[model samples]
Target chain A: MLKVIAQDFIRHEFLETVRPLYQELVEKTRQEKECVSYHLFTDQKDPGYFIFIEEWPDRAALDAHCQTEHFRRLVPLIDSYQTREGTFLLMDAFSAAADS
Target chain B: MLKVIAQDFIRHEFLETVRPLYQELVEKTRQEKECVSYHLFTDQKDPGYFIFIEEWPDRAALDAHCQTEHFRRLVPLIDSYQTREGTFLLMDAFSAAADS
Candidate 1:
């Protein structure tokens, strides 16, 4: 499985504006058959720091997600509110046992 | 729910030493009743970067995890191999709708 950790630091002032967009994207993405899991989180200490922990079956599935309507429409809007460029960490489960 | 993203940048030479310690922790943590999920991942682009994505029912449950025998035994040994200090991001789900 391919796991992604997408981290963003949004401007404090744009929290209200950005949240609904995230919700819309998340809800829509969850319906995609390729998505194993999709979750949105905010740092407890720094509310503006957002993280999306996602799981996909493979790179093709993830690539397909990027082309989805919600991703194309909402991601750029969300990017405009960022304090800095977001970080995307593509990861693999550390062990076969951990994959379970 | 409490979600934690624990990131570590391990020294290159210590990857072998650290991997087993992390596996031990992950396996044991998954057996804990309070642990909703426990996963270990290594950045695909940076093998030395490790991330632990964990979920707990509440603060008390998370605290109890810290006091577990496996955690106490493995974490410090794992820490010793880090190139720099690890990052611990305590986070909350961004929305109630996203919780499922």
Candidate 2:
């Protein structure tokens, strides 16, 4: 599986505004055929910090997701709330005997 | 919910040795009453890099989790495989209307 871990820090005033967008994004992303799972979490120590962890079957699946209308639209709005450009880490899992 | 995002980079040779331990940990952790979910992921660029994303009902549950016999035994074994001390970021999910 292909996995991504992304982090963002929302502006203090924009928390409420950005949450619904995340909710909508999560709702839609989970419905995609390639999506294994998607989650949004906020830091306990920092209210503005948000992290998104997602899994997909492969790069093609993730690429297809980025091209979706909802994702294309959501990206610009999500950008406005950030303290900095978000960090995105792409990862692949090691196959273990236990995976079977 | 309480969430944790943890990262570790294992010595290249130790990857094989560590897999079963993580598998065991995931299996046992999932059986815990407090565990909502637990996931293990590896970085696409770096085979040695591992990330864990976990969720629990609350801090009390997580605290109890750490005290479990399996977890206590697993910690040291995991540590030996590490290139550096791991990072553990504690987080809480925002209570959006969407959560309802």
Give the Å shift of residue B5 in candidate 1. Answer: 0.7
Residue B35 of model 1 has an lDDT of: 92
Query: Could you say which candidate leads in DockQ?
Result: 2
Q: Report the C-alpha displacement of residue A80, candidate 1, in angstroms.
A: 1.1
- Among residues 3 or more apart in sequence or in different chains, the pairs in candidate 1 whose N, CA or C atoms overlap within 3 Å are none
Task: Show how many residue pairs clash in every candidate, following the order shown.
Answer: 0, 3
Which CAPRI category fits model 1? medium
lDDT per residue for candidate 1 within A22-78, as digits (tens), equals 989999999999999999999988878999999999999999999999999999999
Error of 1 at A74 (Å): 0.6
Q: List the residue pairs that clash in candidate 2.
A: A91-B44, A92-B43, A92-B44
TM-scores, all candidates, are 0.92, 0.83
Per-candidate iRMS values, in order, are: 4.0, 3.4
Per-residue lDDT of A1-100 in model 2, one digit per residue for the tens?
Answer: 7889888888978888888888888889898888998888888777788888888888899899999988999977988888888888898664566432
Candidate 2 lDDT tens digits, B1-100: 7889888888988878899888888889899887898888888777778888888888899899999998999978988989999888998765566332
